[model samples]
Target: MKRVVALAALAAALANSARADSATSQDLSKGYAKFSEQGGQALYANVCQACHMADGKGAAGAGRYPSLVADPKLEVSGYAVALVVNGQGAMPPVGRMMDDAQVAAVVNYVRTHFGNRFTDAVTKDDVKAARP
Candidate 1:
């Protein structure tokens, strides 16, 4: 009877852990949608800050987040839109969590800010079309 009770307790603990993980993931995803109207800064903080870092310099380790500052990829608005919408490598697909306008705002902000001088402006239509 003790063995059976111990097994049940272990199973319960595992289930709770899984639930917590799922909730954390959902909260992170929701952060992308938070303050969609507030434009790039808010969106970046809520969604990208965890991985890309607040400075946009990204991290250097086993899996790099790729610095957004002065990145050649930002030279093309479409490229940035596609990356945000479809994601790449270790990056998760965040387009679905954000509306087209939000995507455009964040993409444009990233391209223009972070020591970047890219003049191209990403439109909502561009983000919508880039969705995979």
Candidate 2:
């Protein structure tokens, strides 16, 4: 159907965009390229914003993407870190395509933004430990 085709196209585009964004930071050991985005805001804008929405309120249609806005789950930084590193349910393990620092940056951005006010940061060591 048209919806299926459109979804497929969107997935392909996102995959391609990720690849391009991480082209310069290939991690041969992991067999995946690391995202080149350095800042938390940039990483969020380039990656997480798509599904979670620009407002971090998430979306609902074909699937249920949980809202990051003032979500209590983000209060525990480890939960967010592990989820990013390992994923859960419908969410893909996007952290696999990112380095520890990138993962930390993105997670920190999400926690600090979207009306969520968890001040404690997710360090690179936290992300490294969270990785499978």
**Winner by TM-score:** 2
Highest lDDT against the true fold, candidate:
2
**CA lDDT of each prediction against the hidden true structure:** 0.79, 0.85
lDDT of 2 by residue, 22-130 (tens): 5666622222465556778988887788799899989899778889999998899999999888889978888988889989999999998889899999899999988
- The digit string of per-residue lDDT tens for model 1 on 1-132 reads 999999999988996776578675654332323333348887888877878899999998876778888888788788888888888887877766788899998888888889988876888888878877
Backbone clash pairs for candidate 1 read none
TM-score of 2: 0.74
Per-model TM-score versus the true fold:
0.70, 0.74
Candidate 1 has its poorest 10 consecutive residues by lDDT at 28-37
Model 2, C-alpha of 55: deviation from truth (Å): 0.4
lDDT of 2 at 72: 97
**Candidate 2 weakest ten by summed lDDT:** 27-36
